[model samples]
Target: MAAASGDNPSKLFAMPAIVADRRDDGSILIRSTTPLKASARCVGDWLEHWARQAPDRIFLGERASIETPWSTVSYRDARGIVRRAASWILAKGLSTERPLVILSDNGIDHALLALAAQHVGVPSAAISPAYSLMSKDFDKLKSMIALLDPGAIYVASTKPFAAALAAIAPLHRATIVSGNPDDADALSFRTIAATPESSEVATAFAAVTPETIAKFLFTSGSTGTPKAVINTQLMLTSSQQAKAQTWTFLEQAGEELIILDWLPWSHTFGANHNFNLVLRNGGTLYVDGGKPAPGLFATSLANLRSVVPTVYFNVPRGFDMLIAALRTDDELRRKFFEGTKFAFYAGAALPQNLWDALEELSLQTVGRRLPMVSAWGSTETSPLATDCHFLAKRSGNIGVPIPGTELKLVPSGDKLEVRVRGPNVTPGYWKAPDLTAAAFDDEGFYKIGDAVTFADPDRPELGLFFDGRVAEDFKLNSGTWVSVGTLRVAGIAALAPLAQDIVITGHGRDEVRFLVFPNLAACRALAGLADNADAREAIGHAAVRSAIGQGLARLKAQGGHSSGHATRALLLAEPASVDGGEITDKGYINQRAVLTRRAAAVAVLEDDGASEPIGCAG
Candidate 1:
């Protein structure tokens, strides 16, 4: 089972099997691996099963404080709390008509409340905390509140969200529920959780069917206001079942699984995928307080030192930071890789440099490279459609379609627009019938806006690589379509240690130009400066520009066409704005958002009189 930890985990990996049929109409039907049976009809069924079978097992845990010990809730205890909470919720007449709106980050209380609502046929929507706590204007928060019109709104604490709640107080008549009930308008979470379980709780639970709406997960809203993607019970259960089939190591390990997760429950990747993965498998989840941000990663490092997870999940940035830590901290390196069977990355493509660095560190610490895999899907697809179930040859290989899912690769311009049809996929968006109608095709497959290509066209089993978002790709003035995804990876690889991210801007222009967001730390290190050095000075350093020039030359030399490489580039000192939607909380860039937000930067890149632009050989 640990074979992938060192020599070759792929030997035990289920066969990389795929069946592909190409039609004369230029579409392909691709099916990979046999379908698996769903273990549960609804997400709550797993909680009930574990409560009965493994009553003493810890379901969830988190630290109360650095001075205090970790707080935990067993399956038996969780079920009791959930039942009591559900009774209180039902007493309030809260059903799917008026869903529960959550405004807190991951915690023991938050998870239980959300589960309890779903168990009793009421949908719970976990809105991103940034909308409530971080924003000063509260415009987004107001918009979300108006959309949800929830029967009750939950906040872990009142002080942080007090102002935002005040701003949106007039938007709806939701009953405010707070963990700290100091506010006069709010109900105490403890008071609600202590409600006596009534017969109505069982009746509500019995009425939940596979089609019941479990939750409403909002998209990152990179393009517009976040749309509430309706997640049904079938969607969640089917996705987990498909995951269980591919991840055979979990069952093989034969012990209760442990996870340290920081991904917000507001997002489907964390909520439906990571959260449900642990619960359905009868595993323990430690809600990580730390994030990939520089100051907060310390918390994660502390947690990792104490608790080594059997399987790890993170975005590319987290892995990037972890690789840096593992290089210097010997004890951390050992503990992180210790008994860890697999390393999973998603939210964005893992850079090849980071991928190679992790492999090298694993070789040094654990004497074998663990299977670092990724999956491709969206919130509408229940967060998983295609999974890299087998060993991939390189980065960006999103693998093949998972069991019980069929992928239709339709010809679109030069790329294949990937669409999925499966039980795991969502039926539609919440309260948006028109948008929902436009989301699927006549065959019932959801038109996921992403594109993909076979890693090896001859051998379909080799897996499929993410071709990039079909919407992000644009044409040049010369009528050549630029593959933004392919070029972005190449540009980043060429400019390693200098450019952290690049926004390709050449729509309707003669040539592609890059708005490069320099890696400030790397730039400062090369310039012999301190970590707190000014971003403009670090980016303006002659050595930094020279390194970027070399990278441009490299891209020029390896170019396939004018559209495949940038002709000029400019370093941008501005960071991606989370509020402006230029970047997501997960550190994934929104290409269209950045381009629209910084239209001036694009004009500057094309201006001949602007500061002498760095030029490539092409």
Candidate 2:
């Protein structure tokens, strides 16, 4: 059952009716009316479909700058290139043990290479470029190299990753492929693209089965070193069918569906969800070079000015940056909201302030508010188990499951642990049999480790809000449990744009405190400081401290109990360490990683005399 449905124009983006099957064990199964059935078994099937049906259509696009023209790829052209690349791949004799490894940002080359590998039986692993470019010790990169022992490694340029490549060169016997010419040993990407197609390429593509492992995407390593999650053709294709059923707008739009995405292909959100969704629906994707980070967001803003997409999707942080642009730039706002039907966010729970701000912007620009949607899933679930297709009244509404997937809510300690069983879910982790065995329940459902609570207990179809991970939540000194995920969203909303993310402290302590990571750009803007102000100087400003203090008072004023409010807080200037697993490439903060890395800072928050605190109202 949908929350509301009537003649209201603003409710044009209303939710679909939910079909539920409730069990006696407090476990519930929710799904959509639209059945899930794959039109194509493998991803390559869709590529071939569009190539034959709409050969001249643009499948993917990218640009170097605002002034530059987009370099486009047609479906027909992509198929030819993929076949040629596959022939070259077959020449090298790639197998499961010696797979293809890509270490670079997203591009046409990256997309074609991934498609080529999956078109055959070889599994392609897109390792995060951050590990190679950002890390100082390269310990994580070395570990990954040891685990994969790739048969081939591809990078956009040899110059940027030369040191990282050299460090791991002796570890594995991988053939190097690079787009740029700096590396002497690496094969040229252009040369591979020029390889003639072979008859064996068609046989290899046709032989791919549902059980064939198509990709190996590593987890975010939020709590520890990343584990390689095996994504099969069944997992990826079934998930897309579920999506096509729920989000009918994609099918309705036909080949007209357009998207601009910057999320990394290394992660499932970009690779499986966004990228695969476009291919499945026969749409065009503009590979956005801009990211949510302040410096890089300018590129995103520039891109938006030029191209307005039909369906927009990003993480909450990206919206945070985009909202600021929407508020002041009328031309950008008009272009963004005019053709956009829905805005989707994942990778984190969105703050309510950003939610409200987007609705208001839509109403102001379009004379009607558009739907802001989101879903809940993980890298293992093909990243789409539940999707919110309807117009939710507020934020944090992860609607019922898409068709073909069953959600089993098992009772945990005062929380419901969400488990999933379906073809869309991954079978296991790569090479980690024990970990894979431990990840499932007795009935074979994957134990996702997340907790959920219904929006309305009497109405199962209304949707569910994500509770904190069962392991991340902790009991206070008073034995009251603190839901870190719930409270984090509330705190971010209370602090508005000032606090980008808050690490809830006071675990097993008398009360909850916060180690606040200030959104330096927003804080600087609020403080009327120079653009180049250092983090320390920016966060120490009188205006910034006052805004945070006010936000704390507001949280305390609306508190339900001790765990619901932060009694003390401290602003931190040091950003989250990527190597320490405190932040993912997708801009999601790992609460557990932050707590572990900033243990001393949290300790100081518990002691009033140790640091100057932002006091809460009693």
| Local distance difference test scores for all models | 0.85, 0.86
TM-score per model over all chains: 0.95, 0.96
The residue pairs that clash in candidate 2, if any, are 1-18, 15-390
Give one digit per residue, the lDDT tens place, for model 2 in 42-150.
9999999999988998999999887898999999999999999999998899877889999999999999998999999889999999899987878788888899889
Off by over 4 Å in 2: 1-19, 22-24, 32-34, 181-185
Against the true structure, candidate 2 reaches a TM-score of 0.96
Per-residue lDDT tens digits of candidate 1, residues 60-139? Answer: 98996544567899999999999999999999988777899999999999999999999999999998898887666877
Error of 1 at 564 (Å): 2.8
Residue 195 accuracy (lDDT) in model 1 = 97
- Candidate of highest TM-score: 2
